[model samples]
Target chain A: MVDQLKPGKSIKDTYVFDLKMSERGMRINRLAEWLNGAENREAFKSDMDAVMDRFELTGEEKKLILDNDWLNLVKAGGNIYNVVRIAAIFDVGLYPLGAQQLGMSYEEFLETRNEKGAT
Target chain B: MAMIVAGIGTSHVPSIGAVVDSGRQNTPEWKPLFDAYEPVRTWLSDERKVDAVIVIYNDHACDFSFSKYPTFAVGAASEYAIADEGFGVRPLPPVKGDLDLSAHICRHLVYEEEFDITICKEMAVEHGLLVPMDLCFPQQGEWPVKVIPVQVNVLQHPIPTALRCFKLGAALRRAVESYDRDVNVAVMGTGGMSHQLHGERFGHLNSDFDNWFLDKIESDPQAICGMTHFDLMEQAGAEAVELIMWLTMRGAMTPDAQRIHRNYYAPMTTGMGLITMQDAA
Candidate 1:
């Protein structure tokens, strides 16, 4: 069924946040979803380890969040949007996270776009 | 009876909202994009007199977490709170929902159309719905029109297919037209043109594909409906598959709607595009 949906060509370095990925990233995502509240955000920010422990995030998952590895987080089944929430707790915004995911320096990433520093 | 006046398709990039909120819309880099929407705001308020908007957008792990995300959800609440979205709650007013119209549509979709949408009472809208609202209606204090948010799960896999999205739009038309109300409603589809924000392919933008999509959505929606999720992701980037939401707006319109205004801008990673159409009279 899945193969029927695929085209002849495929995209590299692109991860589709599909059902398999969603199931894989459930724990990390649950922890990230809690950030929607101010109190939860503060709790995560104040003591990252405690919050991670409470969420029961695996060691690899904890490492991904700690390393600020946005790409790896996605690889570990973390949806990009939820990963964005996790990144925010560490004061990392989407653009910088995207830069890290692409293995580009922030300056280099900005240079690739039509409107640089517009946001 | 309620009437469908216009259909709108726009990118709901989060950065666009940040630009508007920060009052930097007139800056050289952002002016072209912001200026494009000025006429849309005027058209909705002055020309269309749109009393309500059915905003078709995706919730990005804000209101519906991945734990139990629904494939399709409809907001039946009287008011929707603005979500924090991790950074902080945006300094925006709560969105007003037309409960009577929403509940009617929800019932119609489930019983008559067999869409089986999850009905939401207390959905906190994030940038997906709000950014498009900001684009089409730059409000001062209160929004000019009430909104009925139709949330789709575009982030997760096993999302409704392009054809399914288009069919939902068609069903929406029936629901809107059947409502015995003296109101003009606009259907707004918010999401991508083309851009990827994940993996090594981050910052992907395909202007050619985006432009093609804009044209096809207006003239030949069936072509778009024929595309699989993989086809869209392969050609337009993984995240660009969100464009399927636009079909919901297009499907609600007449087969030969008149395209009034169209604009496309690839400023950052996303190919920000806007197209407005009115059903043929």
Candidate 2:
């Protein structure tokens, strides 16, 4: 059967969390979604490998989380909101994660913003 | 018959909610942002006397997961719990819902309007809905107005087109007016002026586009309704496409609606913009 719904046109650095991306990142997204609960966050914090294993994340996916690679995680189909959940567990707030993605130090990125004190 | 008294469009940035929760609203950096909302809050609860609000917001993977996401979901529950968006639930009272009105709108959309929306008997709202409520309404022990949550899928691609969202709002106005109850209702279109929160384009902000949008949303919404998601992402940033939800509020109002209040503030990542509209008599 022909697929009726067409994929969104590719933008430079943006990854639209469409059906294909969602399917590819399902394991990681689900794992991150579970972090909504405090108990699950603690379990993941205690034994990272076990939690990742339980979620059936692939080796590459596990490596992405292990390396704390925010940019590549999105490339690996990790939804930004879901990736945020994982980042929170590592004490990485959105601004710092964003700065890392932009290849700038947190302070450097703050300088780029209109109001540095906004954070 | 119920009347649509006004429409509110505001950015529902999660960090703003954090500022409120952490008692930093009075701090130097955040005070201006919170202070901007003071008059707008008074107008909502006092002048308009909005008894209930239909909040059109998108869930940020908090309540519904990727497993079974709905394109459009309407809350039919009597009350909704605050979602724990991977951090923790905000310390806010459960939002009360108008069950009878919700059911009426659900039925009208499905049968009368041919908009087959998922009816959620249970929904936990995230920052998308709560942040706007925090800014617009006064929170004592409980919310002053009942809420009817209308969740849209802006996260996943192939989401509804910008025009479809506006049409949904028009349909909603009909649904609300048809009800036998005599109540003053307001529709809140929450989320985004401009900011992308992922990948290398994460910190993108477009104040010019945000300002243009704030103007067009009131004066020439038809121009906005014709824009594609790609166009919005390119010009405003990826996540800023959530601005389509504002069309729902515009769609629910008169084309000649007067803009009562307007404010623009870009802090860190998001372009926080706010506007209130009331239909011309």
Report the C-alpha lDDT of model 2 over B90-163, residue by residue, as the tens digit.
Answer: 89999999999999999999999999999999999999999999899857899999999999998888788888
* Candidate DockQ scores, in order: 0.78, 0.65
Would you list the clashing residue pairs of candidate 1? Answer: A18-B157
RMSD of 1: 1.4
Over the stretch B1-281, how does candidate 1's per-residue lDDT look in tens digits?
89999999999999888888889889899889988999988998899999999999999988888888899999999999999898888888899999999999999999999999999998999899999998997678888789999999888777889999999999999999999989899999989989888899988888999999999999999999999898898888889899999999999999999998999999888999999999887
Candidate 2, superposed: residue stretches over 4 Å from native: A1-9
RMSD of each: 1.4, 2.0
lDDT of model 1 at position B198: 88
Weakest lDDT window of 10 consecutive positions for candidate 1 chain A: A1-10
Runs of candidate 1 with Cα error greater than 4 angstroms are: A1-10
In order of the candidates, what TM-score does chain B achieve? 0.99, 0.98
- Report the C-alpha lDDT of model 1 over A28-104, residue by residue, as the tens digit: 98999988899998888889999999989999999989998888999999888888888988888888999998778
